[model samples]
Target: MEDVIVPIVLFSVLPVCIWLVSYFNYRKRLTAHETVRHAIDAGQTVSPELIEKMSLLVDPIRADLRRGVLFIAFGAAFAVLGMMVNFEDGDALMPMLGVASFPVFLGLAYLGLWAFGHGNKSA
Candidate 1:
């Protein structure tokens, strides 16, 4: 049970925690962008301060996406390692390898979201 469970916990929890962190970070940046956009929409001058902050906020999301991808990759590698090493005959370690794909899929999904968000193109 430990063999099966430990990997699941690692493959599942690590990415989720990282995703949550990235999500919160993205949300914070989004809120700031909206605030700046609202200010601009209101007929107020686009201050240099707000422009600087917006630029800074936007730059990190790409980096965070990359970091999330890296975390997924690491999880996959760990899963592979887990699969190759046989602890007991009845152990279902390969299933855990499959489980690792969840994070990879999540990272790809986030990348897709990042791409979709590009240029703020709205219909």
Candidate 2:
């Protein structure tokens, strides 16, 4: 019972945490946009700097590179954890590698996007 429940809870929590993060970020962006919209409707002068500050935007290439590196680090951490858990004649590493592959591939995809976008930017 303990093993069954633990795995179920662990797997379930990941999606919930991801959803919560996404929801909060969406709400924050929505609030920022609404504030700008309200200010515009009130006949106030909206400056480009104000919009940029309110949006808290980062460069796309930089953001992608940062995310890619972060995800790769996460994958590496998981792989390390698996290595630490493995004992002589144990097959623990392969399962952990399977789990780590998701983040590794995702990081690679982000890196690819960054490279593609970086090449298209104007000097």
**Residue-level lDDT tens digits of model 2 in 68-96:** 99899999998988888786537999999
Per residue, candidate 1 scores C-alpha lDDT tens digits across 10-87 of: 889969987998899879888987898898899999978868767766564565568568768867886876667646
Residue 64's lDDT within candidate 1 is 50
- Candidate lDDT (C-alpha), each: 0.74, 0.84
Best by TM-score: 2
Clashing pairs in 1: none
For each predicted model, how many residue pairs clash, with residues at least 3 apart or on different chains?
0, 0
* C-alpha lDDT of residue 5 in model 1: 96
Judged by whole-model lDDT over C-alpha atoms, candidate 2 comes out at: 0.84
